[model samples]
Target: MNASPEDPLSQRPSRIRVDLDRLSHNLRSIRAHVGVPVMGIVKANAYGHGLVPVARHIQAQGVEQLGVAFLEEGIVLRQAGITLPILVMGGIFGRQAVQFIEHDLEVTVSSLDKLRQIEAAAEALGRKAVIHLKIDTGMERIGVHSYSAAPFIEAAVASRWCELKGIYSHLACADDPGSPMTLQQLERFQEACAHFERIGAPMPLRHLANSGGILHFPQTHLDMVRPGIMLYGVLPDPVSRRTVDVKPVLSLTSQVIYFKVVKAGNPVSYGATWAPTRNTRVVTVPIGYGDGYPRGLSSRGQVLIRGHAYPVVGRVCMDQFMVDIGDDSAWNEDEVVLIGEQGDAAITVESLAQAAGMSAYEVLVGLNLRIPREYRYS
Candidate 1:
């Protein structure tokens, strides 16, 4: 919404604003709280804030490491000249072994087959491949099960062409501070790590804490902690406590493109899902599901305009949506705050997610690359 003559606004009225200062604040807060190295998770396009920019900024903040969900995400960071220790947490295909080594990326060795693939690639190139052993304590999504991980750990520890840099496991219930499942998974992971000591092998760096763990479980903060949504100043769940002092780093805003008065009992937008009993002032915003604004927010969401909050009037369209302002005055091009503060009012990601009937993660990463992103510090 801050426009100038030289750096004018684009033809589109909606955009996502990223606060880099808030990101730095969150990183520092998490680091100080955990008292360990922080692997800033920038997966899913940095939670839809812009991948390259966010990673670049945080890397400059001197984060210890970085994590992503896919191989291509790491490759993209490398292409952008991000020279930092990046761990590709997803499973690796045999064909990607060479690419991973060439890019100087850390691989997640979830199984013996994956370890063999990396070893072969590294030996063929006469180079050492850095890897982390993944133990499946829970979240049956990936990694070798802790019950049967001894052989896999032994094989990885004996790999000649690979360097075992670290070992880790994903927490399935870390988001729920009261869930006993987290401690159970932690016990299983500790048991798996004990294998390294049992065989007289040095234990690699151990990391298991996630955002929820970072907030609630201090015991899980082993050698490092990976903070994803919390890094962006958003909680992973509705009941998540704000143990760390952090502010939102991203805000969504738009402008009123059209303004008109609707007749009494006349439906607005599609499907005639909502109408006012009396005539009212309505404004159209140039953003909708196409831009990742949830269609479920139709008539359920609220936006701040002219320092006042107004309800969405009807079904959200692909390219636009309607808002009822009643007798309040709002001219064309008036600033509209969708997920940010306007005067004394503010709309948060958690509230918006509740209105959309989606999780906080879905509300964030669901915002595709359709909307332009601008970065600021104030």
Candidate 2:
């Protein structure tokens, strides 16, 4: 069976299908387990799931808050009439503060210096900006130092121009079981929370869990959960060997541009990294590194055709690659899947990430906007 004839292009080839049903299922499962208000991290286009559609779907699934990485992303959601509470996870710098205040979006104040700048900006705009004081914990990337958190929290809470809506911290090693660093960071966050509560700093909502923390440590759930990859149905870490049995939502499919019978000893692809030792049927797919398929997948990548698994041959080029389709039912210049279900076989994003030496987040986020993302409800 194939796609409908009315929309030949949809059924024909060269499109990525988004499974909203799978997405909804994953959202429900995560919400049930996490047991807190989830701020669906839809930044980077919901990890390349198409921002507006995924955000709308997330809204439909009952998530009231959405998190993004930049001010522009939050603006886009606001323009789309999302109306839900959006927390800009990334710091807003320079003149972006006014836009954040105007849109009524919450932002993370990572540095006291940045907070000061924002306060000045809010005064200029004659509006109160809601901000969250971020604690560095052990990430060492952003946020105020745990020791200095007291003063920062006090200043923000007392600032008439700024509204201290919440306090948050990012976890650095929540995925690693033996990383005692998580415990140390948790203790620091707790102490900071206690300090805020004692001094009446008004840290109404406290959160510190990313996807890894939500899955591994229940105690860290606190008042909210910010999950990114897991909501899109990818495990936070592969080493833990946890499989959720949830369906993946994205399908990268293309077509076999051409088919050729190669004689023995004919080297394939650039650098001739792979050569045919025997007469083989080579199936060429029109998808490569240019489309976010990593070049590192060269000979390590796998694809499904007619319920059979075939190894990718040679180096993946910028726009094309060859697969060893072998002597199966004939293949022609038609739709072929490079990263999706083909009959009973499937190439999951996790498998592709492993083959490309990248994380699941990298694999999904690497998908360029040029690739058309088609969404379906069923």
Candidate 3:
């Protein structure tokens, strides 16, 4: 059951399965929920689900735009023949402006000074740079503070070389519906947008909602919505309400490569962490921290096998980990479920994040390039 017949690489014990249909369903669901154009967040290698493939799948599904955290990510999409509008939201330096313009990627204008740098580059190239104004509402991260956004907005509007495309801000607490910070930030964003009216300039598109905002606050869905982790069927916060019915698009499964009977009181794995009080059956899974599976999950994580959940018995190794099955029977080449379902039991990314003492975002992006990913339309 661990092997994929459609994929030759599935023969490898450790592999990732991405359901493009699930991704497509999530994109449509998010758009229907927000009633606005969707900005699919495909950064962090599409949250470890493979960037180019996810981008291509989503782009064909009619998402209005794509958002990435870096210039190189946007360029990669373009190189892969992605033609949808892409905004590099990671905030750019004065130097990265040239590549942004050359690749037809959108720039995030945070300050008058930063705007000027990009303006100069666009002017030199004889191409007006398309840009989005990022206002610092309350995140206090990047962007012009809402209190002083007037001057920055004015300068961007007056710039001859930069074409202001959209104005947006990142939500810091929209994930927590009980947090007052989101409303305050939204108010600040609204006040900042009012500057266009004050100056009698055309208002650019407004977007402030992230995945949390999309689920919790409808008012934040102005001109567009950006669904990051949620687009991949994961919640920003485990407690966040699931307003949209989105299914997970990624699954990590492997085959049991080894089986043995560990004698009572015999320690296992690195650090000689734990041993069974009685003789127990154990199996080795061919994935570990080296594959971006968190080592912190050692002895704490659970995996599904043969329709039952088994605890990881000891410290996870760089390339392998052991699981205790007690009196149950298992054999070599049996399917091992890490972040997916087996029978009625499921190991979700949220549950994995909780067990690993990490955020769902981190857990997804942490599954680095070591594992090969195969896409499934079914």
Query: By lDDT, who's the top model here?
Result: 1
RMSD of each: 1.9, 2.9, 2.1
lDDT of 3 at 205: 96
Q: Write the per-residue lDDT of candidate 3 for residues 1-378, one digit (tens) a residue.
A: 134576665567888899889999999899889898989999999998999999988888889999999999999889989999999998788888999999999999888889999999999999999999999998888999999999999999999999998999999999998888998999999999999999999999999999999999999999999999999999999779999999999999988999999999999998888989999999999999998899999999999999899999899898999999999999998999999888999999999999999999999999977787878986
Clashing pairs in 2: none
* lDDT digits (tens) for residues 204-278 of candidate 2: 688888877877777788999888888887776775434334457888888777889888999999998889889
Give candidate 3 regions above 4 Å deviation: 1-11
Please list the C-alpha lDDT of all candidates, in the order they appear: 0.93, 0.82, 0.92
Candidate 3 vs. true structure, TM-score: 0.97
TM-score of each: 0.97, 0.94, 0.97
Q: Determine which window of 10 residues in candidate 2 has minimal summed lDDT.
A: 1-10
Model 3, residue 169: what's the lDDT? 98
Estimate candidate 1's RMSD in Å.
1.9
